[model samples]
Target: MKLNSIISERWSPVAFSKKVPDDDTIQLLFRAASRAPSSFNAQPWKFIYGIKDVDTMYGYLFDLINDSNQKWVKTAPMLALGIVETVPPGRTSLNRFAWYDTGMSVGNLLAQATDMGLYVHQMGGYDHEKARKVLNLSNVHEPAAMIAIGYKGDPDQLPREIAERENKRQGRKSVSEFVTKNPF
Candidate 1:
């Protein structure tokens, strides 16, 4: 699909089908992320997926997500925790752009999912420490956020409070609001 079309259609999907996504689908999602560009090719982003019932420890990370997310998240058959490792490959130092790299990878993942008739909701209201234990992750892989994926489901499945918020039209700041022609 065209980049503009993809961007226009991409929204944080709050409801997802109960059916779990297939392995091939998951592979493609990560593959898209793998292609994201990074500073010095450091390739600092890493993803740990907890597929279906296979994630016996899912509850650890699952519980960390905000209560607001719990309603719809329970219906999603797949939850992905996207993380970023320490900046740079050789040095134990920080690179300010590592988070940017990870964010781009997530954008790739979301677009790929959308291309496959799937939906993704990126959320930051989660507990990173709990995710670390559930996924058995090391410090090198820090939890950046969680993404719930699947096909879109009935809007009725959401609570009235949530449903109301979901139905509201979303708005964005015009390019004029943030774009500037002059140097600071």
Candidate 2:
């Protein structure tokens, strides 16, 4: 079976080139993300981005990342935090679909980035509490993931152990393992 090239070629990489995406490309990436469907169109996804070496926001985001991810993520020309508003606007109840919708938004972002010859590495390793404090996020806004964005770069630039892991083909389980017509 054949998959779309954009889906097949997309991957998370530890190495990223020094090139920085210009303003238009940055806007387009988020525009694609904004297009993602959401329950009741709450559109709770919000992104905070920082261009490396261009602003203090980058340093603030970098400081939130754990040491393990910082080693390689630092090379990326841009960084971003994916945030979700847990409660739908003007409602006190939790929006159960908030996280799921946020993931779809990021999925749109990944596809758009891949089609544009850029790459994105979504990371869950971050200081969640610190992110809230540093970004001055409101109680409703929750940081979901930190993202590294840039062109794919030389794996040799990564740590020896990580470099060895970088090129390995990641495998997915067969349909039989997870899919079934019967209700669980």
Task: Please tell me which predicted candidate would have the highest TM-score against the true structure.
Answer: 2
lDDT of 2 by residue, 1-184 (tens): 7999999999899989889999999999999999999999999999999999997999999999999999999899999999999997789999999999999999999999999999999999999999999999999999999999999899898889888867887899998999999999
Stretches of candidate 1 exceeding 4 Å from the true structure = 1-3, 133-136
Q: For candidate 2, give the lDDT.
A: 0.94
lDDT of each: 0.80, 0.94
Q: Which is the leading candidate under lDDT?
A: 2
| CA RMSD of all predictions | 2.2, 1.0
The TM-score of candidate 1 is 0.89
List runs of model 2 lying over 4 Å from the truth. none
Tens-place lDDT digits, model 1, residues 43-66: 789876676676854565577788
Error of 2 at 81 (Å): 0.4
Q: What is the Å distance of residue 177 in model 2 from its true position?
A: 1.3
TM-score of 2: 0.96
